[model samples]
Target: MSARDVLEHLQRLGMSGYEAKAYVALVGAGRPVNGYEVAKRSGVPRSTVYETLGKLVARGAAYELRGSSDATEYLPLPPEALLDRMRREFDGSVAVLRSALPAVAAAPEGHLIHGLKDAEAMLDRAEDVIAGARRGLVMSVWPEEMRRLREAVVDAAERDVEVSVVSFGEDADPFGGGRPGAVYQHKYSAPEAVLEDLGYRLLVVVGDRREAVVGGFGEGAAWGIYTADPAVALMAAEYVRQDIALQILADRVGAGEIDRLFATDPGLLRLLGRARS
Candidate 1:
């Protein structure tokens, strides 16, 4: 409605203030505007008028023609055509940027993000990391984190990754009855079994990757760290394997199949230093 509003909108279309003013002056004058006349009428400096008109011409919003005495007169491009070109260029740029988003979003390093959407994005990244795992995924997780682990495992399995876990039950399959992943149950013994009901603030170490995710709520507020380094994963993997053995022994001890968890079994003590921390 006002010159400022028109200028603001035109600026967003890639027009500079002087160029927009010169185009408006040429169209409003209803006649070709020589450089000097455009400068005077548009309030642009005389030396800058030609350059301003050049910008307008580049955007298809104005044109220049040779006049008598070698003077150049400027004509406003058709408003409809100019607007249409601006829209087309903007759309082209947007499409290019949109196509680049997925590649640009891949993680290059460890990052911390708060909340659900970001957590889901990280899980998606994990799926990308594990999509090629053929032998299987070896992960140790706490019970409260079962939901996301379930979703990620189902997604990974859907894509043909074998999923396996060291979880809360000894002698019980970790995948439950209808799930697609493997769960080596009774994985945490004695004091560590106390960790099952302790919410989802747990660590997950699978394949060559290790992550410590500590969060509360269902999904709205959660955070995780992911890394794929060998030394760290080896330690976690060994611990989880030992946890599975411990869960079995603890189950036997609780069931009176074995009277003692210690003093009688040298193997259990040997594995204690290796269980989940």
Candidate 2:
């Protein structure tokens, strides 16, 4: 990776810009460097190199050496040593906060929606929600997504959480290709038809009716909205509930009318024809 990329990564791990630059330069230098040399190599201001180097020494990320003519040289702590020290500090801080924070009563969570752009992130969030479900889960997902999260769903069911799944395919394939829970297959409406029209497959997951994640999964532009707003979560869960209801209705009324309904809808027909090809 480039020096810029390394510096950015170090910054993300809690180093300041100058600190990252100085450290990277020191590592690259192999031998100890004076502040002026560090400033030159790191592209840091000459006037501030001493200050940044001092901070790095205090953080145990660099070593200070006394040299001839009263010149002070700075050597980088080995990368492994610096990483280990930082990891210990981070772990300790997290431990202290985790114990202390719960004593304070949490404020009521407001209606908030988070937009997720990565497909893996969306799937991971859904899996976490499923793993945490106590009472129930309702989900509408494609086989591709189901394949990734099936174990979490099955585990939740094993814990006696009521799990309802809607799988979009022609067969009653269990969502996630695992041991089935309460699953309903939507075969009358082609999911590919919807994908063709919308350019994505919509996956909805509501956990314990407390939170929901709704997303559109395309090739590389997947997007999702995660919300804990009670009303919004309920609405999302209701969407799955209604989908299951439609499947029940289809079972009784036969798929002919339902198939025809999708087949004849102008927009659906356009997509359906595309899906067929």
Candidate 3:
């Protein structure tokens, strides 16, 4: 990249505009230079050059050296040294935040259901739920939802969170085409009939069996509800449990028989047959 681009990137990493320019100028000089020289070469205003140079020295991005004439000269920190210092500081900050925030934050109360709108919002909540999972997660979702939440799910699994998923769609394995946890692919015989009847793909996620998110997407819209209520979470967990039970039953008794039962059941038929308002 060009020198200007490099300076812009350094500015993004918490350096002020004048600091970046002054640091760039010092590096280009390749030796200790007074503030006047930095201001002249970097085109920074003389009024702020000394203050900006002081900030750079304080921030470990530059060093203040006493010249032969007893004038204060500034030397830019080598690029490698500056980057290493920044990396260490950033890592330390994140570690402190990770421990401190959770300890000071208020405990979540149960029985609260927050309604969320749109697929993006639901997916964001899903990511948070998965990332916060301490014990386990149970979910019923389609390939599209699975793909969207794949990274968070994989991270949870890697952290030893037990993950169980009931994937309903054409593809059998949704964890990046490989199995990462317990996966049960629904095998309704008339998949089209089921899909057409619902008119949307349903998604349900329960984290640690304490928090749950239930939603659907399709038909040009998306919606979901997130609940920390113990009762609602229990129900949601059981909902996924039942799906798992059915998959096991289908495995033992044949998927076709289970599909035939669903097709012939009068209650299911009525519910599926109901017209959309």
lDDT of 3 by residue, 65-175 (tens): 998899999988998999999899989988999999999988865467899899999989988888889999898888878888887888888888888888786463546
How many residue-pair clashes does candidate 1 contain?
A: 6
Q: Write the per-residue lDDT of candidate 2 for residues 110-152, one digit (tens) a residue.
A: 6767888899889988987887789999999888888788778
**TM-score-based ranking, best first?**
3, 2, 1
lDDT of 1 by residue, 75-147 (tens): 8887788888889999999899888886689775743423323556555545544553554566665555455
What lDDT score is found at residue 123 in candidate 3?
89
Clashes of each: 6, 1, 1
Using TM-score as the yardstick, the better of models 1 and 3 is 3
Model 3 gets an lDDT of 0.84
Which segments of candidate 2 are over 4 A away from where they belong?
109-191, 203-209, 217-224, 230-277
Would you list the C-alpha lDDT of every candidate in the order shown? 0.63, 0.84, 0.84
Model 2 has an lDDT value of 0.84
lDDT, residue 42, candidate 1: 83
Per-residue error (Å), model 1, residue 265: 5.4
